[model samples]
Target: MPFVKTTWRNSISFKVLLAYVAGVGLSILLIALGAFALITSRSDILLTTDVAERTHELAGKLLFDAAGRPTGFDDSEGDRVWTFKSLGEEIGYRVLDSQANVALASTDQAFWSPVAKAAPSEQGHFKFEREGIPMYAATAPVEHNGATWYLQFAVSERLMELLHQGFAWPFMGAGIVLFSLVLLFVFGACAYFTLGYALKPLREVSESAATISPRSLHSRLESKNVPWEVAPLVRSFNSALERLEQGYRVQQEFLATAAHELKTPLALIRAQIELMAPDKGRDSLLDDVAHMTRQVQQLLLLAETSEAHNYSFAVVDVGEVAQQAAAYLQRMADAACVGIVVAGPADTQTPWQADRSALFTLLKNLLENAIQHAPAGTQVRVEFTTSRLTVRDWGPGVGQAQLPQIFTRFWRGAHRRDHGAGLGLTICQEIARAHGWTLVAQREEPGLSFCLSRHHAGPG
Candidate 1:
């Protein structure tokens, strides 16, 4: 039922096509009805004519002596003299005297009897329904030797019904089929272009909306070119974009000011903590300050990467960048009793065009994440190829359910022990996205691997 409802709501072409077919079908139905009425009406006339003609022939065959009356049946005469073409099933006819008494009946069934209905005038006819069977009859008065007698002829309802059905259905079937094809072609073509013309502005609006990213929020939708019905919607959307751009500008300013205001006080606190005693409590205070400082630095880096126009691309080697990031994080790895191993093609320069600072930060965040999570004495392996850099650590791998959330801001795993804020993977993801690359996280057998690679667009 949901599938049916969705198709019905979304399919304008099918609705239009069905409407066309229905209109044509109704016209054909009306035409068929009129034709049936005409044929049925004409069959009555034909029945009356046939019975009247048969009565006239029967009148000629009437024989009488000095007294005028119907002659007795002759055994030598064949059935032709009595048989009727107008009578179908249960065929029969009656010969009646002037007093309306049945003198002779052609079949074994009881003969038709006159009722209170008006009798047929000379050469005229009347219809009667007896026992639910329509009987058509015509009367012709015959005079023999100065006395009078009458001949009556009749047929049943089944005859006329058969004739009508035979003539009506074939033509109706043919007419419906031909009109269906014609409507499908003519109306289908018209509806296709008509819908396209009507939806043209909506398609343009969609294309324009797709291009308006965070950097392009200043762009507004053009309402003058759209239909009047959709102009209000476009205006409302442009107004919303205006609000968003304003909020984005304010938020960026606040982040920049906060970074400046918070960093100085944090640096003073770290300095003050270092001048204190070498006890566990003092060490804990210093660690807390360092953790806070790292969070602020990551927040600042995230803010910078949000603005894409600030980037400057340079040609750099993936292997060289990986080696430098490992060296920079070596002391941190050693402090945790973990090893750092950088592996790639020997003497192979896998060159790529990227913002060198962004790539370095991307590598730094991933390396830090791998080293922090790695078990003691287990190496964090950094591998580089022409297109991608992968960092694998031999620690408890992320759960399958949590892999998708790893790159989200401030999302930390249950197995993690660091007091570090969870912006590391988020920063790496932002950098990768800024450079049109893809960052992926995979859960290994006994560890997790984070990889960054060049993203390729699909074929047009």
Candidate 2:
């Protein structure tokens, strides 16, 4: 129960729904209260109206003599007579002349005399007590043969008691309660669906935010069709993304520029070292210069591959690229006493849409890294298909804890022995990302397998 309360408090949709229901309930309650107050305050007026109507109806049925003198009511209509008779001793009426003398009365006249005497002479509602029992009375004007008379009607409290005994008030109260419950349900459902629709743009913005990374810093949340209340937040988020994109662009430009600047000095240093006379240190200096040159070149390539527009994409044969990469690294593999084997489809005719040069670089880097890691006299396997490429090396693979950092920039696992900079896997990952693909490194039984494939939508 506390969990439910906490969730309801924390959830914006639930809070909105609760507030809406409360507002609707309050409005309905106010309306019911107002209606009850009106009915209660005007109850006497309603009873007086009832008495006046009954007096008029009885006046209409009066039978007079030829001299236009007051007489009794005509009972020719059996239904009307039966309705009046059903009231028993609860209803009584009296007709008075201009002299204020009783000209005629109902059969139960004695039961109403005290009430009539206590009533006011005015033609409206009046309250009185008769033998300790409360009574309601009304006086109305009567006209016959151009002479004016008055009629007084009285009803006993027993009539209202009969209505209560019949369960009239209970039925009415139950009906009101049922109506309020149904209205609350309907309003709650409407609030739920309306909130879901109204908040749809927020969900879209969240999804778009989740997909944004350093590689996709230029992407922005869509603002169209967003609610007015949330538009400012969306605009602010897009503005932040724009700033991040500018900063990332500047950082990449700096890296590329630094690499470009170092290339010439390194070339000069290599030339001078080669021009030196043969000595024990001369070859070592040249080797160090060569390694620095290679590191600079890899930095330039990393910066270039990080951007999407740097690659010129086209349809190329994947099998052909794999073979070329293998052949290019064959000398290095032989120097390390590691064999290179390329195996795939029978025809080796796999076609894919990618940048030919970038594709070659990606495959070359993977195979080079595999060759460097493979044990002496062991073969590094290269597999290619229409949708995926796999490079497997039978060497000491990194631990499971190090798998996530394999593709991280400058992250050389414990098993690697290469003197080169650790940008090979990071470059491969960048190239795969540029092509809308994923590069994953899996720990094999006795080695590591790097799989490059298109990003599939569902689980593997």
Candidate 3:
């Protein structure tokens, strides 16, 4: 299937397994061929060498008289006599003098005489036929009592057939096949386990990378125990993180600097507007200046909250913080003709560890956002516990599609009543992130609810 092929192409483990299997198969095939060739070449050589050795051995066993004329063999109780008896008619030999005359021959002399005559003069192997049966022969020189003689030994072709077709070929083939299978299995298992062990560090690197964000860009992958082949990639990735961290820090610094620079001029403009005579244009100018000043201050707070190191952490009560935020936004709720209610666990003792100032800012922003959206005479409820906080307003909640964009920087929903900059929810989300928490928006049947909960283990 196409899926299988794609996996084979893309997966490292599949590729490695395939390569290992192929390499092992090729090696096994080559070894089997080489071994077969060696056996084939050695079989012929062994036959000839065996014939020559038997010729010499028979010559040594020949018995002679005092005049040095050849007689019958000693026929002693030894290996040569036993070999002659065991082979019976399959083996034949002849001993000839310096004049090339036969001195002694096996009982079957008629068949062996032609073979001896056809043998080479010097020591070597030759072939002949006896009654249409093919045979192999070898001639060798012999010395006895300072007289030189030649011995020719012949064996039937059936002997070679027995060695090749009868036993060696079949056993060698089965052994090669069995050995190749066992080797493939054992080596394949070893390769699979080794590849898994080697790739463990990569999995660890992935987990570490998942934890990295603008806030925790300082983290890097650990290199210890990693394979040498992958070490360079890990180093390169760490170097990339270093560069990214530097760029993010520079951007945060620019945002903070720009917001700080705008604050002083806005203050001076406000002081100047206050000096002007009471008029409709003067009030409009002051309102515009105040909105700009609020936007600048929110930008500064966003920059600070985005960095993990900016917040000082300590134990703080969630319920108390909720009450404080409600009280702080009471005037704004009153101006909008909306009631503010705080409800949570009765315990006042601090139970959560967080940056007190950042937590206050986060609560304040959520409550302020709720107050701005709630309908007249409707209540904006603030609820909290040791682990969570929620702010709900009885007003026209945003559509489902707009829920995800509520915490995005400078993003305002369709439900709005003022010309204020949309950085409040974004600042709240950043503060929650710095404290290893999650802030989310859900649509209550008749309102929108914002929940900030201690959910994650660490900053992004």
TM-score of each: 0.64, 0.81, 0.80
TM-score: model 3 vs. ground truth? 0.80
RMSD in Å for all candidates? 12.2, 5.5, 5.7
On TM-score, the candidate that comes out on top is 2
Tens-place lDDT per residue, model 1, 1-460, is 1433465546766677677778777876787687667665766776677667866776676655445556643444346654443343435555666565666666544445433433333425877776788878778887666656666666666765565467545676677677767766786688778877887888899899988877677899878789898899999999999999999988977876787688999999989989988899999998898898888887888788877776888788878988899999999998989999999999889887788888888898888888878889898999888877889999998888888899888888776668778888888887787777888999898899988787554100
lDDT of 2: 0.81
Question: Could you give candidate 2's per-residue lDDT for residues 1-460 as a string of tens digits?
Answer: 1433455578779889878888878987887786577445646666666667776777677777888877777766345555446764676677877666777776465666565343234646777767777777777777788987777777776675456435655676677788788778876787788899998888888899989977789888999978988899999999999998999999999999999999999999999989999998999998899889889999999999998778787779989988999889888999999998898899658888889999899999989888878889998998887788899999998898888998998887665556778898899998988888888999998999999896444111
Cα displacement (Å) at residue 265, model 3: 0.6
Over 4 Å off, model 1: 1-9, 34-180, 200-204, 207-227, 274-281, 415-417, 457-460
Better of 1 and 2 by lDDT: 2
Q: Kindly give the stretch of ten consecutive residues in candidate 2 with the minimal lDDT sum.
A: 115-124
TM-score of 1: 0.64
Q: Is candidate 1 or candidate 3 better by lDDT?
A: 3
Candidate 3 local lDDT, 1-460, one digit each (tens): 1433455578788899998889988988898888778666756666677666766666677777898877757757254655555775667777778777888776466776455444346546787787777777877777778997777778877776677657877898888888888878987898998888888888788798888878789888898877888889989999999999899999999999999999999999999999999999999999899899999999998999888878888878877777788888788888999999988776566367889889889888888888888889999898777778789998999998888888888998666677668999999988887888888999999999988788547532
lDDT of every predicted structure (CA atoms): 0.76, 0.81, 0.81
